[model samples]
Target: MSVSSQHEGLCLRYPEPLGPQANVSYEAAVSMLMRAIQLAQHTPFVWGYIDKPQEGHIYLIFMTQQLPFPPDGIRYQDQEQKIIMPAGPGRELEVMEVKFGFVPNSSDTTAWRVRRRYRMHKGGHPQLVLIHYGRGQPMPIMPNLNQPVRNYPLRPINEPALFVMGEKIGQKVYPNQHSGPAERPGPPGMGMSFGGIGNQQAMLAQQNNNLEALERRSQRDRSGSMNARAPPPARIEDDDSADESDMMSTRTLALTRYKRNHELMNEVFMYAAFSRKKEFPPPKSPYSVFDIANVEARVAKMTAEIDELRSKAEARREARSNADGAVGDDPGDVSMEVSGTTEEVPT
Candidate 1:
C-alpha cells in the first residue's frame, strides 16, 4: 500500500523524464534511503537495498563512523560492533537487519558481529552484518542485481552531496529532532563531514551567489543602464554537473514567465470584449484593474460617441423623408432600406 500528498498548482501537468546524467537532490535521495532503513528494521516484513558493491561499502562506513547512533535495529554487517544512541526517553526500540547485495546469504550475524568487532579493535576493514532480530526470524533481504529498483531518486557520485540529516533523518524512525551546542562526532577516514541544517543553508546561500550575479546582469539588461554585451553565465570549475543543475533551475524560471505572459493575455482579451466598467470584478480577480477609475472615463467617452452617431442617423433619416418613420421591436428587423448607406442599429 502507498500513500501520497499533492499540491494542485505546483503539480506539473507533464513532468519531463530525468536523464541518466541528471543529478538528484541530495536531501531527497538521503531521505528515501533513511525510509528504506526504517522499513528494514522497524517493519516485520523484509525491506532492503541493492546497490553497487563500492556504494554499499561507503554507506556502511559513513553510517557507523559519522552517525550519532544506530536506530533500534540498525546493525552494520562488516564491522564487529554494537552501536547505541544517546540516552533519552519516549524512544522506541527497533529490530533492524541489513544484507549487502553482493554478500553471501549463508553469513551468520552474531559470528560476523564478533569478527567485525575484533577487526575494528585491531584497526582494519571488517566483515560486517547488522542483525536486529531474533535467531529464528529471517533477516531482511536485498533485491537481486537484475531486480534493482529503477526510477528511484538517487544521487550520482559526481553530484555535490549537500545535505544535513541532523541527529536523525526525516520525521521518521528515530531522533525526530535535535538542537544543542553538542559537537557531534563525524565520520573519520572518509572526506565526509556532518553539519546541521544551518550549515547546509550556508552552502546553498554560497551557491546562489552565482545566481544573484546572473540577476544583476539581467537588471542591467532590463534597465539599459550599460550598453555592453551581456555577460555569459558563470560556470563552476567542475565539468557539466553545475551546468546541468543550472539548466534545470533556468528551465523552471522560463516556464514560469511563459505561463504568466499567457495568463496576462487572456485577462486583457476578456476585458476588451466587455469593458471592466460594465463588469467591475473583485479586486483580486484575474482581470486587470490598474486603470479602473480611468475605465469609467473611457466608458463615458464611448457613450458620447454613440450618442453623436444617433444624432447623425436622425438627421439623415429626417433629410431622406419626413414621413419615413417606423417602430420595430425586433433587433433583426430591416425595414426602410436605404441604398448605398450603412444603417446604424437603434441604441
Candidate 2:
C-alpha cells in the first residue's frame, strides 16, 4: 500500500513480530483493507493499515484520512490505480470489545501528579479482546495474531470487520435478489439437530399435545422474523464453486460520501504558479479547517512546556532528597530534652 508523501509523519509504525500461528487468510486481509479504505473516505480522522510483512510480522502504519477521490483540477498519486463501479452497500459488521486500563508505575504520589500533566500516567493503553461472546473458544488479541478493525459510524463495507476478521463470510450478493441469509443452514451445518426424537411409548400418549406445542413455537419464530426490517437486497451465496479467492467479484468498492479536503478552493487564493494540469501537493491534514499556519509553532510550545514541568519536578525531588540526607547525617540528639531549671516569670 502506498501513502501520501505530505502526510507521511502522521502515521506510526509498530515493528512487533506476529507469530505464524496468528496468520490471517489472504482473502480476509484483503476484505479488512478494503473496509479500512472505505472508513478513511467516510470519516474525518487519521487512519491507516495494520500491514503484514513478509515474515508475517504485524506492522501497523497510520496516516491522516484523505478525501475519497481527488477534487477538480487535482489528481491523486494512484489516480489510475483506483477503480469505481456502482455497488449496493457494505454488509453489517461486528463491533469488537475494547477494554481500557491503567498502566501501573512505581513513582511516588507527588511525582505521579506532576507527570500526569503531560500524558496519561495510567489509562492510556487498552486491552483488545475477542468478540466471540462464548460462541466457541476464548480468543485474546495479541499484536501478531489479531488484525485491526475498521469501523464506520453509519454502516460497514459489506459487513463490520469484526465478523469477518480473518476471512469473509456469508453468501455473495446478486443484482436483483435479497442479500440476507434467510434460508441458510443451522449453526452446526445442515441436517443436524440435538436431542433424540420421542420413542413410541411416550410419543403415542402425547401425539396431539406435542404437535400443538411445536406448531406454536414455530409460529412465534416466523412472526418475529417477519416483523424485523430487512436490509438492502443482495444475492445469496449459493455458488458452491466460489471460494475465498473468487468472492467479492462483480462488486465495486467506492466512497459513499464526498469529503471536503478542498484543494480547488485554495487554488483561487494562491498565485497561479502552476497550471491546472499539474497535480497539487497533498494537504498535511484531511480537513481544510485544521490546516493552520502556526500548527508547528504550537506543537513546539507544548513541547517546551513539558520540558519546563519536568525540570521543576526534578528540582522538587532533589530538594526532598537533600533534606532527608541532612537529617540522617546530623550528629546532634534528635530527641527533645527537658529543661532542668525553670526561668522566673516576667510581668
Candidate 3:
C-alpha cells in the first residue's frame, strides 16, 4: 500500500482483540480504533482492533507492518473480500458479511461447528464480513485461521478526537525542555536582563518619577476644568425652576387639547344620533371655540329638555284617551233614554 506523507516511516502494529468482557459498546470500540488511527498519523505506531471473541461476532484487525510469522509456514491465498469506503461526508461505518467456504486445516472442527451454527442462526445465508478499508482489495488467506482476514491501506476515520488523559488527543505533544530558569517579565519601560541589578533599580525609580509627574499634571488639569465648567449655585437653581415651569405648562396645554378633542368627538356622536336630518356637520379647526365644559353643560340641558318633553307627551296621550272614553259613555246613555221613550209611546 502507498503510504501518505503523514504516515510515512510509521508502522502500525496488529490491533489487539476486544471481547465482550471489556464492557465497551460497538460505537465506543469504533471510537477507540479511530482515535488510535489518528494518533498513528503523528506517531511511529498505533494498535487498535474491533472484535468480540464469540459466535456470530465479526473481527476487524488493523495492522500496517508485516506479519511476524515465518514466510514458509504461512501461505497467503487470495480470497474475495469486499471493501467499504465512506461514500460522502457524515456517513456511518457499514459492515458486510460474506460466506467463507475455505476453512483453515490447523483449527479444530469445533470452530467450524460454531461457524455453521452462526450461519444457521442467520438462516443459512452466506456469511460475508467486510472491513472498512480505504479501497477494495483481496483478503489474504492463511493457515489456522477459521475466518477471513483482509489487509488494505489505512485511512483516518472522520470523527472528533477521543477524550484521553495526559495526552493531547488528535495533536502531538512535544517535550519542551529549558536548560536554565525561565526568564521573568521585566518592569514596565525596562528590558529584561540577567545582570546589573543596580541599573534596573535606577531605571525603575526614574519610571516612577515620570509616572508621578504625569499623575500630578492630570490632577491639576482635572481641577482646572472642573472650576471652569461649574455653574453658580443661584444660576443652577434658576435654570431648574425655569425647566419645571416649562414642563408644567406643556403638560397642561396637552391635557386641554386632549379634553377638547374628546368633547368634539362626543358632540359629533350626539348630533349624529339626535339631529332632525341625521347629518353631521363638517369638522372645525382645533383653534375653534369648542369648550369642553360648555359642551358638557349643553349636553345636560338637552337631556333635561328631552325628559320633560317625554313626560308631557305621555300625560297628553293619557288625557286624550280619558276624554274619548267619557264621550262614548254619554252616547251609550242617550241611546238608552231613547229606547225608554219609545217603550212608553208604545204603551
Candidate 4:
C-alpha cells in the first residue's frame, strides 16, 4: 500500500498518479500536514505531497532542521511563521512555515517552489492554508533531515548493581504500619484537661524508655552468650602443612577485608567529588551535641582581647594629641617672648 493509503484516516485525499491537477479541501489538507509532522517526531524523517488543484500546485512537506527564508517580494513579521493547532486533548502542536517558494522549476528539486499561505477563519475553527505549485512539476526529493543519534553516558563497570530483590539499591524499605506497635489508649480524662494530657505524655515517654532499656539488655546478653560459646583458640600443630593452611586462611581474610574497605573508600571519594561540584548544602550539626559552653568561653576571651586593644589604641591617641597641644603652646610662648624683647629694645 502507498504511504497515503496507510494514513487514510489522517484526511489526506490526494490521488495516486499525477493528473493535470487534483482537488482537495483546505481543512483536509491542513489535517494531513499536521499529522505527518507529528509522526515525523518519532521517526528519523518523513515527507509527503499534497495537491492543491484550486491553486494548481503540489506542496512537498518535509521535516527539516534548518529554517527556510521567504522568497523575494514576500515579507513576514518573523523569519519563520508559527501556526498553533490542536493536536490532542489538552495539547497543542506548533508548526513553523520556515520556507516559502514562488518560482517553480523542473530541474532543482531541493528548492521549495510552492508557496504555502495560511488563512484564519471567522469563527473558532481550524485554520486553512492555500498551497500553490506548478501543475506538471514532479515531486521534490525528500530533504536529508534525519536527526543525529544521541550518545548517552554508560554506567561504569565498577559501579555497584542498582537492583536488589526487586527493589532499587539503597531504597528505604519502611516497616509496614500494621507491623508497628499498636497505639496506646490515652489516660482517663485525656484532652479534657492539660494535666491529663501531660500524664499521658509522661506515661508514653516512660514506656519508650523501658522498651529501649530492654532492647539494650537483650543485645548485651546475646553478645555475652555468643562470646561464652566461642571455641578456645586451636593449639599450634608441629606439621608444616597445618601451619601453611592457617597462614593462608588468615591472608585470605585480610585480603577480603582490604578489598571491601577499598570499595567503600572509592564510593566515599566519588560522593565527595560529586557533592563538591554540585555545591550541595553541608549536613547540619546536631545542636544537642554542640559544645555551647566552650564556644561562649572563647567568645568571652575574644571580647576581652578586643576591649584591651581598643583601650590601648585610645590611650595612644590621647597621648599623641596631648604631645601635639604641648608643642603648639611652646611655639606660641617663644613667639610672644621674642615680641616683648623687640618692644623693649625699641623703647
Which candidate has the top score in TM-score?
A: 3
Q: After best superposition, candidate 1 residue 28: deviation in angstroms?
A: 10
Cα shift from native, residue 143, model 2 (Å): 93
Give the distance in Å from residue 111's predicted Cα in candidate 3 to where it truly belongs: 9.7
Question: What is candidate 4's TM-score against the reference?
Answer: 0.19
Ordered from best to worst lDDT, the candidate numbers read 4, 3, 1, 2
lDDT (C-alpha, whole model) for all candidates:
0.30, 0.28, 0.34, 0.35
Show model 2 residue runs off by greater than 4 Å: 1-285, 334-347
Instruction: State the lDDT of candidate 2 residue by residue for 111-230, as single tens digits.
Output: 111000011112211111111111112223233322222221212122111111111232332324321222222232111011123453332234334323433443554466556756
Can you list the residue pairs that collide in candidate 4? 57-133
Model 2 gets an lDDT of: 0.28
Question: Pairs clashing in candidate 3?
Answer: 97-128, 97-129, 98-127, 98-128, 98-129, 99-127
Tens digit per residue, CA lDDT, model 1, 143-216: 33223223334322221121112211111212221211011221221111121234555534443443344334
Predicted candidate 4 versus true structure: per-residue lDDT over 228-293, tens digit per residue? 676534533222244223222343335445876889899999888776555568788778576999
RMSD of each: 26.8, 34.5, 30.2, 30.3
Best by lDDT: 4
Candidate 2 vs. true structure, TM-score: 0.15
Worst 10 residues of 3 by lDDT: 116-125
